[model samples]
Target chain A: QQQVKQSPQSLIVQKGGIPIINCAYENTAFDYFPWYQQFPGKGPALLIAIRPDVSEKKEGRFTISFNKSAKQFSLHIMDSQPGDSATYFCAATPAERGGADGLTFGKGTHLIIQP
Target chain B: DVKVTQSSRYLVKRTGEKVFLECVQDMDHENMFWYRQDPGLGLRLIYFSYDVKMKEKGDIPEGYSVSREKKERFSLILESASTNQTSMYLCASSRSRTGRGETQYFGPGTRLLVL
Candidate 1:
């Protein structure tokens, strides 16, 4: 069973526009939600993360809006640039695992910013 | 900065051959993970180790095995390489912490093609 599900297998947006990718989880035990960005020829890197305690968290042009009650979270890139075009993955983990048990990841969304 | 390195960026092997993929982390992190990334399946954990010689199977551990003889190194082995095993393999590392949030650093990934 896919515990975590992500939508829009691909996305395209113009430069300076906001591209939003969303994910949902069925496991309530999940408390840590993180977004990763992957550029071609490189591994996915930690872009931003959010805990269930917060409704939203922002870092630079990247923002994570989390709804614990809804068991959903979304990543938004502000002023999207061509450099930001890549694959994005959303992952979740339970706190009881202590961040050592690894994570459950979404299938990923391929984003493209048309310049 | 945490650096995770995979032994190879691209490797081609014949079916039924034994395969070994090595990963090394420079951050001395206590937690290391092995995952296989596919086009539409995202990233699925194969195995993870929290300490030397201690390993745990992840969601999809079938047809794969891992060894962690040192805190900074982890190895994934395929007893007999199969065409179905062709995919991009990623290594990740993180600090062992008892919490809900932790950052995972990933390697560039090794793309294996089994014929």
Candidate 2:
């Protein structure tokens, strides 16, 4: 079973436009939500993360909006550029596992910013 | 800065042959993970270790096994390589801070093909 589901398998946006990717989880045990970005020929890297305590988090041009009650989270890139084009994945982990259980990941979203 | 290195960027193997993928992390992290990434499947954890001589099965550990004789190195072994196992393999490491979600750093990834 896919515990986490991501929408918009692929996306394209104009430069400077805001591109949003949404994700939802089915397990209530999940407490940590993180977004990862991957470029071709490279592994995924941590972009930003959010915990249940906060409803939103922003780092640079990346922002994660989390809704604890709905078990959903979304990633928004502000003033996205062509360089921001990559595959983005949303992942979750249960607090009970103590951060050692590894992560459950979404199918991934391929985002492209047109010049 | 955290650096995770994989043994090879690409590899090719024959069916029924034994294959090994090695990973090393320079940050002295206590947790290490191995995952497989496919076109539509995203990243699926195969195995993880929290410390030396310790290992745990992730969601998809059916055709793979792992070893962590040392804290800095983790190895993923395929007992009998198959065409279906051809995919991109990734290694990641994170600090072992219980209860709090830690950021996971990833390597460049190894693309393997089985014939």
How close is each model in CA RMSD to the real structure?
0.9, 1.0
Per-model C-alpha lDDT, please? 0.94, 0.94
**Which pairs of residues clash in candidate 2, taking residues 3 or more apart in a chain or in different chains?**
none
lDDT of 2: 0.94
lDDT of 1 by residue, A11-106 (tens): 999999999999999999898998999999999999999999999999999999999888999999999999999999999998666688888999
Candidate whose DockQ is highest: 1
**Clashing residue pairs in candidate 1 (N, C-alpha, C atoms within 3 angstroms):** none
Worst 10 residues of 1 chain A by lDDT: A94-103
* DockQ per candidate, 2 decimals: 0.79, 0.74
**Residue A67's lDDT in candidate 1:** 90
The C-alpha local distance difference test score for the whole of candidate 1 amounts to: 0.94
**What is the DockQ of the complex in model 1?**
0.79
Q: In candidate 2, which residue ranges exceed 4 Å CA deviation?
A: B97-99
Q: Where does model 1 exceed 4 Å of error? A: none
lDDT of 2 at A17: 100
